[model samples]
Target: GEYEVLGEIGRGAMGVVYRARPVGTNLVVALKRVEASGLEGTEAVRRFREEVENASGLRHPHIVPIYHVGEQDGRPFYTMALIGGGSLEQKLGQYQADPRAAVTLLAKVARAVHYAHQRRLLHRDLKPGNILLDEAGEPQVADFGLATKLDPGGAAAGGPMAGSLPWMAPEAVRRDATLTTAVDVWALGVILYELLTGRRPFGGKDRSEMRTGILQAELIPPRVVNPRVSRDLDAICRRCLESDPDKRYESASALALDLERWLRDEPVRARNTGRLERLVKWTRRRPATASGLTFLALLLVAGIVAAVTMANEQDARLRQEVCRGNEFAARHVASTVLAQLQHFGEAVEGTAASTKLTEACDGGDWPAVEELLKARLLDTPPGPGAPPFATAFVLDPEGIIRAECPQRHRVVGGDFRDRDYFRGARARADRPEGERVHLSRVFTSKNDGLDKLAVSVPFRLKSGGPVWVLGATVPTDATLGVGGLHDKARKAFSVLLAPRESDGEEYVILVHPGYESREPSVPFPAGRLRPTETGFAADDDYADPVAARHPDYRGRWLAGFAPVPGTDLVVLVQQPYDEAVAPYRAFFRKFLEWLVAAAVVGALLVAGLWLSRSGHGARV
Candidate 1:
């Protein structure tokens, strides 16, 4: 029997939703029906089934539940729970004049959308219209019929569906349909903008115009539209709506965390606008006076000088610091590689002992030797514990793998003799030098497919020949501890590891924690290293002469380089310049302020004395 279709509840480009009750149960639900005539028959059926299957799998409280799917009179239909309240679009219109209520409501919707994203589903059609409010005013995200699973392989070919264009991310509009969680982030930014400013960030009369605006137009800052919104909030919104997907928050969780942090009065994760914004904010808050103007001018001049000086000092310090950090990380990673090699060596030695016995009993069993080698090669290492390094790969002296801890099929017989680490170790071994570990200059790995630090230690065979050079490869990302180095000191400070090239040229290889925000100065060569700057040079007694002439720079930063134990690399640590120099900046500001006050007072006294003298003369 054909299922009965009830009154229409909502309609859109893809389908129409209706109020319906299933047979025998009398259970009321909202049924969505897609017109088969409007789309390709098999493709439409597949899409409908996929949507139903995907939507049914989601079990979050914020997401609307999909109940059942079937055909009624040759048309596809899916039923979902009938959410009782109006859509968020209606709520927005109802509360158009109230910014606080709108922001609060949109934040709730963001949370729901974020929940869906956590499950790897993107509500590609995330607009106020798609979000429905329940009786208790909780947002329930509906109409996932247009949602797409974030499968990198199954990305759609065309531009995002037209209905969702207003809330679509710029990349989505550009039809770069990788459709990451960043799309959701962009939509949330639009919602936030609309909520605060009482209007869509980019609006036009038609879809084409809207798409054009979204793809090309810059977002008007929330503060520009609504003066009451704080600069911090504006910054957050701008970050979310950044045209470049890479610049946007990586995920909805990151966005939600930032928003929650902002609400809780915690420091937000966003870019700082630096002294320009600070100066503007200061000027806006102050009264205009002759002394005040002079003070402001002096302050600006001093700040520019300080920033330039800091940049120079930072350039040198950053290289040293990155070198030190990478060197530290390299040593740890090298140790891990060394341990794996030592284990492999033991395995090889054991196999050799067994093979000798087998050979003595059976006239030199070559097949048995081959089988033993294969078995030892195929043996997997134990689970890597929480080591300081990210990854460990091993290579023998000929740059061939005897065994690698993180076993990969590609590196087993691969030749690495041309690699710097291999060449350096072999050269050292040719000198009949004692088995020593040589840390290769930090360079991006050409064979391992990542930026890596290579540590090579030569192993001598029983015949006094360099049999194998054990090379350990540690990926730079892993060594730097991606996103795991956040600390109070890191927040106000920076650390870097710089390595010197063969000709004594230093350059930055690694910067830990918050390198993106501070934009630390490190003089890495554009393509190749320059002479006179061999990686980072450590001077425990290093002092900036320019800073020495200016007391403000005294004790602003303490820097020292220590050789990464067991490696030629150096680790440099720089204390927080802001914290170290806060006292000085504050003192200088106060001193200048008092000096201006004193000068003003002295001028007034002189003027009074002259006036009194003139009055005495007139009386005479």
Candidate 2:
């Protein structure tokens, strides 16, 4: 042997495969020799060579890479990266009952198939035997012998379509059917079914019977066979196995992404078909039969209406409980925030009134003023684990920072004349003397680049002149203050919103877990939370299509809001609406399922009784 054949891997319709060590190289490769009896002709060899050239162009981690093509003793052969773990066929037993494992494996393979399709090539024969696993147990598609190079219109060129009958698409079973990329999708669905349920979806004793089954058989959904298979996975499998090629996924990529979505626990397109949509599709397929079942369905619908009324009542109760719970949480959080803000205010006010600070400022002893500020605000107080204030600084009459605690030398001479805090403190004379401490709008601190709320208090070395502002900064993200109040509210998350002074936006989100930086408020989605005379209330409307269709809609949320008692800030708590009404929704779905089943049985009984009476009358 020119190459040392370590062992025979397998024999297939295209060639005999061997695990071989190439001559004069340390590399081990899987070599296939084109020794199939009828494929020895020159044209056949050329086509094989062309197919290998095309397969070689595919470079994907999940697709076997062809290394070399050669011929020896008038037999063509090609070598590819040797996958040592064996074919997926041999490993099917391991993932028999594990749908996630099967989906994880198939998603990669589906993506590789899609990659081939993008380059106008079709892997017409995608079966478990053709999917090889490497040492790491990653699937790599192999054996593209029946692969077709599609034309520009995406149709396979003329040839006798060859595929394993068991894995062939229904359209492929018919001689007149046009071949397309959907055949590959159908094969993947079969492999996925086998992986999930340990048996193929369509099977029979002979090829003829199997073809019939493939064309006409009602598929026992993957979930029905393996209770462990989820509805999403079952739907995905069914979508791929649609007998009508047009009904199948548009491309292998679509199938792959749906499977990946399922793996990520996100919404999948396959499972988005609502029950009514499924019913409509079924009725459209059999109009006459649907007409016969209409009366029975109406009776079922009447029952469904009654059940929905009861469910709505139960849901209303749940919604009330959830809303009240959210309101309580919001109030508690608001109170906590108010107390913290008041404490911060008192600290700023007391520092502003200090006689020692006034003496230092009057004498132009800036270092003494900085020390006093640091002692009062920068040093950790007895109760807090860390200092509550991020920074404390004194500004001159011109709003220039004269001195700062934990001083940044660069910020010492920096002017903040345009800042809201500076402007608000300078105008404090317009308000009553007791309201001199002003809470500025949330602003990003220049010193630390974190969102900070400034509590600014104005004081004078002499009465009513040269008012210098004393300001303390508190971080919005700190656990000891504003953002942490919702820590105990497990069912809901909190947002702190500050009333905006500018135009075009309602509020500026001071703190939100969802946003990376500050953002202007968008309209509160309709039917989610609305203002009532007493307080906030959630509407019972379930068909808010805007929220349902918007990609960014986190989910439907029932919200409660409370204003911080002395400030314009609002603490809003939102809980997922679905979770709050989950019990009622689940019970309703089960009820509809049973009602539909019972309706079918009842309809059949009524028809049988009517027929028996008619036959007796005819005999008389």
Candidate 3:
């Protein structure tokens, strides 16, 4: 023997693989030997040779590389890279709990399969058992014994239908059906489904039942089986399991691409987006300012593809990109708004919780509390990091404005019991001392006659006295406040929507694009400026990009929403869909015109050559 057989690693249908070291070398390798039963005839020997040939032809980081081939005692054997981490089948438990890891591993495997496909080789028996993982958990495709070169039609031409039964495609089960790369995709889908849901998409008692299941059983969506599975992942898995070969991903590469998109938090081609999820995904992706550069790069790539695809389809792709861009922008702005709101809320909470302010309120010192509020207000200067609050005030247990910053003496004794800010703070008095602050609904100030939003916290004055509320108000139209949603282009802007008090209640827009220009005299009702799809369900639908016309805004828009944590405020970023996509559409139109002109020129040249040939024949 030319090698020292360390031990038998595993056995399969046709042969056994062993851990061995070549004779005169310290290197370890996997040496596979054909069993006596497998080497019974010339056909078996040829199959053994073919496996080595097929595996050797593939050169990829994720594919097992063949090292040597030989025979011993009339039994053929071949040596290849020794993978110590074992097969994917042995390590399936890790993926059971983490669908993302499963997807990532499968994506790499799918790429290896795609590599083989590009070389006209088909891995007819792709399964977890055949996928070897290295020590670092990187997947390396192995066992290409069933691999066959693709015929002229890009399908397996002849030979008996062979593949792992459980992971086979419906077409593969039908012996006479043409087999393409789709069978491998079907297996990849099965692997993904099992990883996501911890169970196979189709199961049965026996081979016949399994075939029947593959051919006819309805695939339970991955999300339905495992509630934790995301909608995007479910869609990707379902697309791979589609019974119709044409409906499945056209190639293994396409399947891998969809998986990559899911990992990147981008909209996958497995399903149409432009739904609420797209916006939600953008938050996780943390869309950066480089989105424009990303779009430009995508545009360059698309221009190259424009040559093969129809101009109309190219135009659609461009629009899709723009829609995504709008979603990204909206998500970015929403995050900024949420951070700012959280900063303000923290400041208000911190000031109210201070020992000095607490001592002033804990005693019968309304004047002292008023002075403390004024000093605290000045501490946070009116600059970039300043709180948006224009005035800070203290109210007695009777809801009387006891004292206020900048000393509005005329309103010091005014009662504000009916005000939402006062009521909101009082309502939360039963809560823990640290958690007693409340963000009130939008309302107009009685004294200033201007729209105001308030954050109020409840505290007790003198252990014997009833609880008092300390509050701060930000004018709705303040330049640096939520109401100041200034979008210079008017194409896109951010709006702050106050959450509904109860189910089925309308969501009021506390801030809007034109809030600065609105008349101060006209009273704005709480429900007057409601926007559609502002409910909790719509805000939570995070698997699709939200692109539709907002009824209140009166135009089709691509929007993204983010909820301000620990508060009832929601930030909505809306971009007019048409305006966002216009530039891309114009570029596509120019590309289409060039394509048409080139076609016309080529046609004219052909016609001219034909006429000259006819005239030359007449002269002869």
List the candidates' TM-scores in order: 0.42, 0.46, 0.45
lDDT of 3 at 608: 67
Which run of 10 residues does model 1 get worst, by summed lDDT?
381-390
What is the RMSD, in Å, between candidate 2 and the native fold over all Cα? 14.2
- At residue 326, give the lDDT of candidate 2: 77
- What ranges in model 1 sit over 4 Å off? 1-5, 24-26, 36-43, 94-100, 152-163, 271-620
Candidate 3, residues 61-105: lDDT per residue as tens digits?
999999988888888899999999989988887887887899899
How would you encode candidate 1's per-residue C-alpha lDDT over 554-603 as one tens digit per residue?
45444433343344444444444455445556765675566567656755
Badly placed stretches (over 4 Å) of model 3 are 38-40, 275-620
Estimate the lDDT of model 3.
Answer: 0.73
RMSD after CA superposition, every candidate:
15.3, 14.2, 25.1
For candidate 3, which ten residues in a row score worst on lDDT? 537-546
Q: Which candidate should be chosen as best, given lDDT against the real structure?
A: 2
User: Ranking under TM-score, best-scoring first?
Assistant: 2, 3, 1
The superposed Cα distance between candidate 2 and the true structure at residue 489, in angstroms, equals: 6.8
Q: What is the lDDT of candidate 2?
A: 0.78
